[model samples]
Target: MSGYLADKNICCGCGACENVCPTKAIAMGYDDEGFLYPSLEQTKCVDCRACERVCPVKLDANKGYPDYLKTYAGYSTKKEVMEHCTSGGFATELSQLILQKGGVVFGVRYAKDYIKAEYVCVTQEEDLKALMSSKYVQSEKKDVYQAVKKTLLTNKTVLFIGCPCDVSALKLFLGKEYENLFTCELVCMGVTSYKIAEEYKEYTEKKNKAKLTFINARSKKNGWFVPHLEERFDNGKTKLTTLFGSYYGYGFQVYNRPSCFQCRYCDKNGVADFRVGDFWGIKETDEFWNPNGVSCIFVRTERGLALLKEIEERGFKLFKTDYEKATVNNMSSLHNKAEKYVVLREKFARIYKEEGLVRACKKTESFSVKLKRMLPKGMRAFAKKIYHKLHDKKTR
Candidate 1:
């Protein structure tokens, strides 16, 4: 196996190694944090080294920002589409286009009653709804890469949307680019542990005494900037919490995988043809600013530009904008430095396993975090804006 990874922390858990193993010697095993790592069955190992050869961490060494062909800030004209997507419905719109052309679309979706996220394929327009919106937790690739390979072999069109690391891993595993394949990478901020997500689900279900029927982590019910986590219960009740005041908020602050802190894909030179993310700091005076939502789209490759042109011709609302201005405040795409929450994250994971989720959260919550959570909705919103302004100024 050529020592797939010397240290587990460096693995992005993309499952490329498992997918490329010829003898099925590699299996994905979970750590305490609920992130996957490759494990080799010594008895079945043939020392082929294929797993190491396909590792994205080893292959994506010359990574940097690619010259953007074009940039845009726009949203879908369809209100219903924008309402369900995380950003400006760009992904949903693109997926619909692929489906209409009889192509396959692969993306993350909830499984096992919303406790986990995994990649699923959809070939029908009606099924595209299942792959919409953001999934904050790390998603299990689970043989989807192999499925994509098989579909490509059939000369069928395929669109794969995922975090940058997953896209890189798929590219490395395939060993070459396919003309029929299209990839879109999300501007990621990092993914939280599934263990944390599961704990939160259990706590909420127990507290409410009901099953969670539906969850929208990126709901625009209260507007895009102040997004809320909307949860629907089986008993006809609903719960709405600010995205910044929920467990997801805590994850945003800390508790992502170790590799996320030192992400190699957080640059302009990504592996995907297109990069899409929230236009975080869009100003009220900007032409694309809408209370509904807005997406910052970067066309990085010729294929991406061609797809953008096709979508534009088909009546998608896209406005060309300055690349620097479009990405000025979107730190997720440019920031490569790891956060300083490693120690705190480790402590939280240990405490979470020893105690319960609530206690672990209470133990880790800083005074400022507590204060933010305690503030009223309006005050919290105001505080968040001020915080973002200061952050942008300092980072600039």
Candidate 2:
């Protein structure tokens, strides 16, 4: 209620306040740490508390986790779709279903510059490709909530996909849920800064000697179990490297926004009707185990269940699973905090303010990571195989 919408550690920066402000008094601006915070203009402010009402972080802080109606592991039957997506392609399947019903889908995609990701509206099936993979960076919402409400008011079906905080913010902004609107929140492990995303792009382009044309943070080309970043350059070249090899991915859990470290929505009862993410711990021996990809989904509402049923009827594969096994290797999807390296994270922020992300990550990286990076490619792969073998055993 102070002049700002919420303090840095509490604000998720969903931009609902800026979108809902009647006087256009609220503007989202980046602080020294490069995360967005609401800036209020007292001159144009009506003091109506519309911004306050739309803030999910402030309103839903004390909400308890709800019991899920069901849990499942699945993937799209289409090889082409599953191969190109970050996870099982269930989100793409849902978007396709909504589009077939003459509905619009809302998801995130890189901006024209490709340095930042932002919410985009997709009404055509072909356009869904833009939203295919995961973007670890926090996306800019820029009036997207208003656009979503406007579309829903027309009585058309809409499928909105985003992180749990974003889904909650949109629901709060609408003040009520419309039957025509469906939301699917991605099970998130927090998000990094635009500054880090931008710095990584510059670093990659500088090293590759060409401007970056495209990037997929979680490409499944080499298979889903192993994470990689696929990058394309204007000079007609493409590169695929391990997730840890990428600057943005290397600093992921360590350099997330202050609010993300204390995320309140990382629970079984998320804000969205359903939650979807990689089914990381599915064993090779399981019948539903797919090397191509598999998605872990938790249905929290009847509408979510109905959507799952429809996908199953339309040839998407679904396997009944329990929450415990489904979340085995992906506990960050349900945990509230990432407390691994608080001291190092603070040092990272301080170094980043002066030297930028690439240098900061290099300075703060663990000795093990540095050693792994130094290994020969073949040796590194062998080591990774051994690590995964042990990890799979632990999870099992």
**Best candidate (score: lDDT):** 2
Let me know the TM-score candidate 2 reaches against the reference structure: 0.95
Give me the candidate number with maximum TM-score.
2
TM, every model: 0.94, 0.95
lDDT of model 2, residue 194: 78
User: What are the per-residue Cα lDDT tens digits for candidate 2 across 1-396?
Assistant: 333487777899999999999889999988876688888889898788888898888888788866888999999999778878888998999999999999999999988767678999999999999999988878999989999999999999999999999999999999987999999999987888877778888888899999998888888766777687789999999998777766777877578888877888876756787899999777778889888889998999988898889989999999999988888777677686646666778989898888988888889998867765677555655666577668877867
Worst ten in a row by lDDT for model 2:
376-385
Name the 10 consecutive residues with the lowest summed lDDT in model 1: 1-10
lDDT of candidate 1 over 296-393, digit per residue (tens): 99888988888888887877789888667777667667875434477787787788778967777789888887886788877866876787778667
> Which runs of model 2 end up more than 4 angstroms from their true locations?
1-4, 375-396
